[model samples]
Target: MLPRPPRTVQVLALWAACTATSLLILRLGAADTGATPWAGPAPSWGEHLRFWDAGWYERIARQGYPAVLPVDGAGVVQQNAWAFMPLLPLLTGLLTWSGAGFYPLAAVVCLAASAGAAVVLDRWLAPRAGGAASLWAVALVWSSPCAAVLQVPYGESLGLLLVCAGLWLAGRRRFLAALPLVALAALARPVGVPLTGALGLWWLMEEAQARGTVPRAALARLLPGHEVLEARQRRGLLVLVLGAATATAAWPVAAWLVTGRVDAYTATETAWRQGAAPDVLPWLARSATWVGPHLGWLLVLGVLAAGALVLSAPGVRSLGAVPWCWCVSYCLYLLVFFDPTSSVFRLLLPLAPAAWAVGRAGTRVRALLLVAGVVGQLFWVSWVWDRTVQMTWIP
Candidate 1:
């Protein structure tokens, strides 16, 4: 029998293969749709990377954020450059100014960040789930339909890298070391704020579990007759909690400072809804319209219940308190705030803990799931890429 390759080699090989296959799939889709994959008048390799939100990042890299927010007649802010985060554009801008084109440099940045995220996720999961599951997690992430965004000039890859790295570090109890990564992640996306909440919830759970009786530990700590939490552990937990809170506030605070509007970020984000505010009634109505009147509410309830079960299930719980908290909190956030569009799948990529559960399935089930994932990826890539090029939807 041949000796098996090292884990690192295996991961990189799988990632490369998946990436190549996705690009080929995109190419074939483009050919079928009679769409040109190139971006500009003069074609380049970078042009092949351009699609959907990639254009927004490219614009920000070429020209910084608007000095003034564009508003309509009714004084509602339009969806402008500020809706995008600054980190990716900042890095891409530096590259562009140094003679690199926006598309190519941004693509490089995204791809590298995604590769780093894959490594971190695998390393983080391996200790808890074993080597095979760790590799499976990486494979599943790479082959996900939404992973096409990772290949573009978007910030999702970088944000995922930072968030996963921080979560991994925090899981190992290196709270202080994880601070900067969490801070950078906050700057990368609004989801970063919720991630802090997830971390805090995990810390509270860990503290309660450490004492063996959650309610008694709480009462004892409140009464001051017993030390539910040791001085060192308490201080470490406080620092982590505080650091994450501060980091989560960094981006919105920066937006406020720059725009002189308290709701600058939120307001800009609202523009994407085209005047439809995030309300439960409207969400339910839309759900009904899509899924049918009687079944829509049932579907919503069923999905929410199923998601709750999956996040709290033994496999996910075994990953650790922090990962469990992150998955649960992130899913709830999506349910309340985000529209139920295809973008939800892309947004869920940050919840790497969920993948750990899927990775732990038996070999036959895992193989079946992977095959289904690839099929889904093929359909998603074809539909999304075609729509993006045709200017129908944002990828």
Candidate 2:
């Protein structure tokens, strides 16, 4: 057999392939539906990148967010510009200010961020899994059902880049260096808050082990007892915690300053649910309406069981304390807070680390799973992207 290319080469090739395939799929869907890729009256390649949340980002870029929240005649908060985060729009605004068109610049920003994320994932996994396995992990992440989000102007690409890069830095014991990335990640999406929480939990677990007080058997075995953290570790942990807290508060605090309401961010987010309660019963009832009662409950239970099994996999459990903690904590956070709508798949993009567990399988199994993921991506793009532009679904 011939020698393999460097891991970087392989990863880049994979990222390019996946990105091109996604764009092709988007183009085909647009043609079939007689819709253009660009947002307005004319068709253009940039159209494919401007859908759903892309419009919000473009608006923020062209015209800054509202100084005050907008409310309808009924006193309900209408979808105001503040509902979205600032980082992506700020970047797009800078590009637009430089005389670049909004949609094209936004697409470039998203595509670059997406590629950077894949590279970071490869580097993070290469040490734990060999080159081949790490490559598989990257492939799986890019081929996820909602992977199309990476190609759009949405914040998921930038958010994933920060999360993965921060975690990778943390894995190398560069806690201080990871702090700023985590801070930025927190601003990218609400997932950053949980990401910081996970890092803190990891630090606590490390501290506990250092103090010879193991909280659980799994943790005890994962991190054998050692003397209390060196002065450096302790200092690093303090800085990380402070940075994370500040980052998490950045959005909420901004909202409060703008709207003079403590619940400004929460209220804007809740508006998307249209006043619907977040209870599981309501979700199940809604699902029942779409698919009969018997199948609906069964589907819910099946998803829960599958999630539990995946989380419990030995590979996932065996991850280094920080990654494991981050994964489990993030998953639990989503379960309680995120509504189980179709968007859940997109929301789950932060769980990219879980792909490592799948990559641990034998070559044949890994290949089959990768193929399945690619197929899922095609179908997901067709279903979500096609319908979302038609106003049939919310991406």
lDDT of 2 by residue, 103-188 (tens): 78877888888999999987886666567777788888887778888888899999999988988887777888998899888777
Tens digit of lDDT per residue, candidate 1, span 231-250? 57656766877888887777
lDDT accuracy of residue 226 in candidate 2? 22
Give the TM-score comparing model 2 with the true structure, all chains together: 0.89
Q: If scored against the real structure, what TM-score would every candidate get?
A: 0.89, 0.89
Worst 10 residues of 2 by lDDT: 220-229
Model 1: per-residue Cα lDDT at residue 390: 45
Instruction: Go through the candidates in order and give each one's C-alpha lDDT.
Output: 0.74, 0.76
